[model samples]
Target: MRAVSLVPSLTEAIARSAPGAVAGATDWCTHPPDLDVVRVGGTKNPDTGRILSLAPDLVIANEEENRAPDLEALREAGAEVLVTEVRDVPQAFRELDRVLDACGVPSHPRWLDEAEDVWSSLPPPATRRTAVVPVWRRPWMVLGRDTFAGDVLARLGVGHVYATHPDRYPRIPLEELRAAAPDVVVLPDEPYRFTADDGPEAFRGLPCALVSGRHLTWYGPSLAEAPRVLGRALRAARP
Candidate 1:
């Protein structure tokens, strides 16, 4: 089946679940880099004409990925669109099932079961201090309470002092970094890449670790591998 994936998170799942079946994907679909697949552009402004020309049997889009115009165009072209939206872990599983169903692949309930089991089995993170940079510079955003990243940190035995905040991403006064007094500041490398060379001068006097943002945020079958990688990094960087 010729399918086009426009979401980055689902791109990974589609690549793992369907392998070489993805005929067209977005530029951000680097989880399984499409060295040969057609590019429909990107999540926000996917080339509707290019995707339409491919004449795909199925098109996988996400509420968060495709803009209304492109989505409308796909529908106008009479493409069978399977839209997926994920917020929490359970919703992620439900969306995965839908994608699998779209691809005509057998639903792998065991994988979801295993992921939930692994997630539940994780010892809640300790009260050790930690700070996650959700966005870089400009407004200076941070992960607040109830976000997927916050949940991951909570499970890793790390404390998120900002867990009381309402928004998933909250704009913070840059000076608050000093006030938080976190033992370790984690600068993630995606959505806004924060690197070691970049230095934690802004967080001067605070311990810091640049982390893989994908592992901290993206949850899916990849979590099976990510938890271990993130856990090790967190442990090694422990103060």
Candidate 2:
């Protein structure tokens, strides 16, 4: 069966379910690295025409990634869409199970068990330090409480300094970031593309870590490696 995954998280899930069966993926889809999947624009502005042309039997979407109007259009076009909302780790695992069930693929319980084992093996997070994860540019939005990144940070033994903010990705003033004095500012590679070279000038004076956004924030089987890489970065960035 052919499928199109608009969300990055679901893209990974779809890939894990049936590696080469995913005929289309969003521009943000990077996991499973080099599968010959079709690029159908992005999660926000999916090329509906191009996707329809693929004649997919199933379409995977997410509340965070797929736009409302676009999703409506797809529904009107008679496509069977499976929309998933993954706010935390439990939801993420459930979504993976859903994908495998929908695709009629056997669930990889052993693999998932191993992934959970890895997560459980990690040490408790460093309670003293706080970290901010920037996921956008220009206005400079950061991951707040109630996001996948926040949960991942908690698992890695780090604290979300911006968790008190109401929004998941609120744009904070430079002065606030400076005043907050986070022990480590993690600049993720995608969704915002911040690198070490483009350090926050106000906080460049402080310690920082240039981290792989996927490993630190992404939820899926990839989460298996998160604690190790994130723990290393957090420890090394300590003053």
Candidate 3:
């Protein structure tokens, strides 16, 4: 089955599970760096015309990572697109299995099984901390309300202060963020490349953990190692 994965994590999972099943992928789907496929553009703004040209049997996308109009456009063009929504760990696993199966994977792949095992077997958190997780700078958009990332962090004993906010991703003034005074400031490497030197300085007193965006955000194979990796980062940032 020729599939076009619009999400980076899905692309990686598909590529790893089935050698050459993906016929097209977004430019940002860079996991298997050597994955040679037709570049379909970015997740938010994929080139529907180019995508349709490949004549993919299936197109995989995420509710959050992809735009509705683009997916609809693909559907209008006669491409069968499977959009997956992953609001939490359980949802992510279920969607992954469904997506893989739809892409012709006869059964659950080893990586997927390992990923499930890791999350299911995680021990109690060593410590819990309240954090202000920032995804972007400039205007300072943060993880708020019911987000997959928030659920992931909750599982790891780190809770973001904005989880109760009205908006999923609210643009708050930097001053307001500093005023919140969370125990730690969790910064991810994607959406905005927050490095140790770049994002930490803004939160002077708050311990900042620069975590891998793929582990913290993406909901595919990375989920297997996300617990350990993100847990270590959160632990290290404890003040």
What is the TM-score of each predicted model, taking all chains together? Answer: 0.84, 0.92, 0.97
Cα distance off (Å), candidate 2, residue 239: 7.2
| Candidate 1 ranges beyond 4 A from true positions | 33-35, 109-114, 126-130
Tens-digit per-residue lDDT, 1-239, candidate 2: 89998877667766776767799988888877776788999889999989999999988888887898888888899988988877777777777788767876775755566777786676665465678777776777888868877887776656768887888889987677767877788777777777655755546577777777777666666777777787777776622
Q: CA shift at 122, candidate 1, in angstroms?
A: 1.9
Give lDDT tens digits, candidate 1, residues 1-239.
78888877666776777777788888877775543688889789889889988888888887754787788889998988888766555566677888877886776745566777787677755555566554576768887766667767666767666777887678888788668888677778877878766636677777776788777776556666567877777665532
Report the number of clashing residue pairs per model.
Answer: 3, 2, 0
Q: Which clashing pairs does model 1 show?
A: 125-157, 125-158, 126-157
Q: In angstroms, give how far residue 227 of model 1 lies from its true place.
A: 1.5
Q: What C-alpha root-mean-square deviation, in Å, does candidate 3 show against the real structure?
A: 1.1
Tell me which of candidates 2 and 3 scores higher on TM-score: 3
lDDT of 3 at 10: 94
What is candidate 3's lDDT per residue for 1-239, written digit by digit as tens?
99999999999999988889999999999888899999999999999999999989999998899999999999998999999998899999999889888988898888899999999998888888788999998889999998999999998888899999999999999999999999899999998999978888888888889899999989888988998899788778833
